[model samples]
Target: MEAKKAVRDQIISNHDIAEKFRLLADLLEIKGEASYKIAAYRKAADSIDHTPEPLSTLRQQGKLETIPGVGKAIAQKIEDLLDTGTFELLEEVTSEYPPTLRELLQVPDLGPKRVKLLWGELKVGSLDALELAIEDGRIYKVKGLGPKAIERIIEGLKSLKGRDIRIPIGKARELGKRIVQQLLEKTDKVEKIELAGSIRRFRETAGDIDIVAASEHPEDIIDTFCSLPMVQDVNMKGENRCRVMIEGGIQVDLICLPAQHWGTLLLHFTGSRDHNLHLRDLALERGAHMSEYGFKKNEQLITFSTEEEVYKFLGIQYVPPEMREDRGEIELSLIHQLPKVIRQKDIRGDLHMHSTWSDGKCSIRDMALAARSLGYEYICITDHSQSLGIARGLTPERIVEQRKEIESLNKELAPFKILQGIEMEVLSDGSMDLPEEVLRDLDLVIASVHSGLRQGREKVTSRALAAIRHPLVDILAHPTGRIIGSREGGDFDLETIFREAARTGTILEVDGDPNRLDLRDVNAQEAVDSGCLISISSDAHSIEGLYNMEYGVGTAARGWIRPQDVINTRPLDEMLKLLKRNRS
Candidate 1:
């Protein structure tokens, strides 16, 4: 009886509904269905995934079809999912094909057609079976499976292992904030709530989410948290603690305590292992012991109301969460010498962005307007150059046309300038894609190697160095060309690149796109320490993308990059003057 009740009450979220649609679409494709049918399901999945209001709420109001791309049929399916936790189309498709067959589609280069081919040819329906096929050399017998393709499949499998375990910082923060927002909005039980753990530390990726909440009634808060609509299952529940598996297969632990212990609880959970251990040693030296409740000294528990108070009690400076990585932060805090790392508010402009002139979704005017809305003083329009035709790279004539539009926009949006720039590609043989005259005429030129990313260390390093040495080049964007977990970054002699970049007065970019975040924290630290100027940019393709700058700022803070170390944080005139073209 209890098992049946549990099954009936299984939580269903928008993400779960969207996943069902996506899997159904993939199954249709693998089954050789009509292209339009597959496309409809895919479109519906995207729309459902992005819809702000819960589909269950929409169903209650009989307005699910109001969502874009959600037709009456899709709405009915969604309603059925909300009511019964399963829909007809998904069941029908899963019966025809082993549900695990869809998992193969996640491997790079193994699309629905390849998955179909492998399944039909080798009876490979799961990752385990695919591995066995590879081990027995049966995979090579499949048509169109070449040596290079097989190599990519192997690497993709390895990448998936880590990808499955760690969540990108951007995704983790979004999930964490959503949970916090929901908890605050839905119930009055929570007095204070904050994201803790690695998400708090602003690491590039997070293993899991940890949230600490303060409330006079701890049990009520924990119960409310475990019952959130996004929670898929309750892993464990205690009087003051609960662990839940959220919609996207990530574990979230919520710890509730009395308001008086908020500071100690947050400090205990927002740690880097070594950072906390160091604090414990410091406490012991002071004839005290520390725990989540407070410091125990002379058999008395001394608690703090705020983190500042806790730090003051310890006779040390309050360390920012991102700097609590035990990397000389404690020593620096003791001496009152901790660097004021760059913050999001310190940013004045974005030096890298795209517009419809290239493959960007927004127009130059729209992007400029969006940046201005964010209180940005200026932005540079750095669309792709001609050689990278895949992104609709602009020709020399197109560059001239774009400048006219930028000039006109600048007049309309006074005090909010738009600088003309190009993301000029570095050819395989260490040559500039656009001519010197065209590059020199622009307000800024960002050189990057997009095509020859896999051309080995020496050749790729030479291409990068040539671009950095170019007098017209002012910044290097996404220097290593890494796409986080999916692709490996360029194997370059970064120390040499940093030295030359500093000497040539070229700034290096820390791309703000969560997937990119190139010149990641460690690299940014080494570059700034080596005297290379760094610029944090969103590399945004749309107006909403401009907000990604916070992720870049987080990465910068993790690297201990001060405001003076980043060029975009400076005033418009100072920033332009520092560019290679304006420098004497």
Candidate 2:
């Protein structure tokens, strides 16, 4: 009875519920399910995911069906999942398509149809089998599996190799913050707490979480940390440090020190190893040795309460944590010439987002209200264009209607403008989806490659370059098309694309989606270095997603992008004048 009660009491978050639906949708698609059925499941999943309230609460209130895209049938499925952890259709579906096949979906460029083809034709049912097929060159014979596609699969598999060990930066930070919050709220004697290490540096992925704290009673804090509900097992405990395995097998180490040592401790732990080595060499040059406690100068100990003080003592400008990758930041700091990277507050608007008109969970007014709450001066409703029907892409007629709605919202929410825009698809032949006349009159046009991402490098490059050269197009969104751990970006000559964008005055995007920080840091830097203007945007699909701007800005900062480098940082009129169509 107690076990059953505990099971019933288990908290299943909205993300958990949504993931099941999404996985079911993918598996059903691989089973050759009807297009409309697959779309319904995916849509329901998106709605559930974006919902701010807990579905369990909604279910208790019998309001699950109230969610957009979730009808009576879907509501029952949610109830079944909540009650017993699985539903009949999910069980039946997994039987038809081996659950293992779902793993293949994680491989880049291998969507449902491609996975079905490989499974049916090559019997590539598992990652090992798929790898063997690739090794034996058997995948080459699969009708739709081209050489480029196989290369992407190879790269995707390589990325997944160690994925289970580390979490993405967004998830890691979220978890890190939660742990820190719990400690501060529940524990005693913790004077200062900060997340440190690679996570602090805003790396794309993190292995273990590092947290540093300052306290006079370090042992009390360490004990409380080890006993937290999230800590699965305490691996080691010392006077000043404790290492524990958290709920998901993620290792977290808490290093507690005297309050006076925070500056040096944070600097030592928030390191790239290479960065610390450089700092150590610099300290040696000054007749001192560095440690987490402090620098030692001629048998005297020096400590600081803040990072800025430590840098000041070293006679260098303080390097932001995101720039602490030892990528010549120290040298630049010595010269007092570090780039003033773009910050969250510097952004004036978000230009690329979706709405209910095109697979977004929120209405235009709801999305606009959410943006207004974030202090954004403006946002462009760049819904997917006509060719991408899966997203309910707007037809020319629908776009005309959308403009009417935008104009209404712009007036209602006076001063918070909504720019009517379209995320026009760059089709397989390098021709854009919308007619030129339709695209020309919009407030903004974002040309993106949504299909045929597996084309060879030259073809893909041409596709992208053609879009960049289009006079109506103002920005190239998520130029790489990579999904972090899930997929590798398209193979394109980014140098050529960047160069072309520079010449054409087309802006390149540093997308803020955690999963698709396309034009990843290195590429964003290269794009900027090539003299291309940048736009940092949260390709947010829901209001909660608007917060993803921080991730994008972090990526841009790592690339050394400054506010002046990002066009959206400018005021609305100046920003308009900078767009390709408006540029004199």
Candidate 3:
């Protein structure tokens, strides 16, 4: 029970961390100032709890600095928390408001700005104060807070008794697409509309909808948007941009640009801010002015009618939204240029997937047919092996049957190649689920440790190396299995895993599952540095999950993976040759 309580406490603390960062980040974004830096902190805090080493343990060991993205300032605060029982930065921030204000900020529909509004404008700092202030009818009169918004705020406050569904990026995109379609129907002035930022790049999770539209009449666009069924409250109204709070407490930004400004608007709103900033600086250096209106050289404005023109004027061939993160792309893009974006057609096959034979919701035949229909040249049906009983792992008998089914399916669909495979479990003893004979027969093998996750560093390194060095293993999937907002897996020396994987001609998978975008961007870069051939797989359990593969691709590109570096980008014949050549 004590252990349970400690776990509960830890979970609560993590919740606070995620909530504060998100709330603060949103407030900073809405205020439209220093957002990228605040967003970096929020993104860093978002990833920390997913890290295996307790931020506490790392801080205690004076190694919080080792975590990617944490940096010295955050690390020092983490260290302070380890030495004391509280986080100094959080404590200091909360001190400016009331402690309860921090808790109140967690309520849906409320943000740091709202709390700041309540504190500064209304002299209401805490929930109790807000309640009293609301009862007395004072909060409704603030500059940004009005009656309808306040009423919705209180409704959200009351609804906190129930849980709201936090949606995935794909689902949010579907909803946003629906909204775009509706607006398009309402006006022919709607020249272009697309999701920008991380959603456009297919991030797993998302905060809000960023909708940009190029139009003839901006007022009609705003009217069409506010006319949408999702909008519950219009927070701010401007000719160019409008912030509307939607149902489920999700915020959506509708930016309407004159058709002439569409290119600049898209380029600006589609920003990975670091990338935009560097581009802005570059425009300055080249005696060009860069703005949402487009790039200008000298005193004259050079606006693009399309995003392509914007990039050309900036002298970058074009930087795809996925590659925007200011991670040294500017320097490379300046030297020799590649195509601005990766097309869906470029992917030759879906390399990592499960079937009904394992945890997947579909059959091998169904998945293969679906992939073929989607223009894939090949599909590998990799079921989990016996060690993962929960996934209905294939026993040796099942493995034989599975191969027969694949072979039969291949015969039926003669043109499309089928790779018989297993997401084999690498047991704690460093033995594989399928013995040597079964592994040799397989076209591809992925060995992953799903259990014994508590084994410390050396054991994890050994298990990973054992999997990589084994003659049959081809790729290691979700090596860490660290789920976002959940328990973390043990630590392995990633440097060692990459070195071993490289030497063994094994690939390391960057899992695309939103909940488990394992071997995250930083680790993927580390793998690249180690000369490991990287593969981005959805680790797809469902057909819908397969679509999330682009998230892995996006994360990979952010880590600077070129087309030549990813294995699945290979055509069927070449991929087969590579696999067979590396077959041990």
Q: TM-score per candidate, in order?
A: 0.88, 0.87, 0.69
User: Candidate 1: lDDT over CA atoms?
Assistant: 0.88
Candidate 1's TM-score: 0.88
Q: Model 3, clash count?
A: 0
Provide the lDDT at 189 for model 1: 74
For candidate 2, lDDT tens digit of each residue in 1-584?
A: 56546655776667678888988998888988898998899889978877878898898898999998899999999987787777899999877677678788877667888899988898777788888888898988988777888887788787776575678888888778867876886777889899898788878889899999999999889988987767779999998999999766899999999999999999999988999999999899999999999999999999999999999988999998889998999999999998788889999999999999997868989989999898999999889998898889999999999999998888899889999999999999999999988998799999998778879999999999999999999999999888877767789998899999999999999999988888799999999899999999888888878888988999999998899999999989999999999987
Q: Write one digit per residue (lDDT tens) for candidate 1, span 400-517.
A: 9988988998899997899999999999999999998898789999998987677889999999999999999999999999886666778988999999999999999999999888
Q: Each candidate: what lDDT? A: 0.88, 0.88, 0.74
Q: Whose TM-score is higher: candidate 2's or candidate 3's?
A: 2
Off by over 4 Å in 2: 9-23, 31-100, 109-166, 181-185, 188-191, 298-300
Candidate 3 or 1, higher TM-score: 1
lDDT of 2: 0.88
- Model 1, runs deviating above 4 Å: 1-14, 17-51, 55-99, 105-113, 162-164
Q: Lowest summed lDDT over 10 consecutive residues: which window, candidate 3?
A: 7-16
What total of clashing residue pairs does each candidate reach? 0, 0, 0
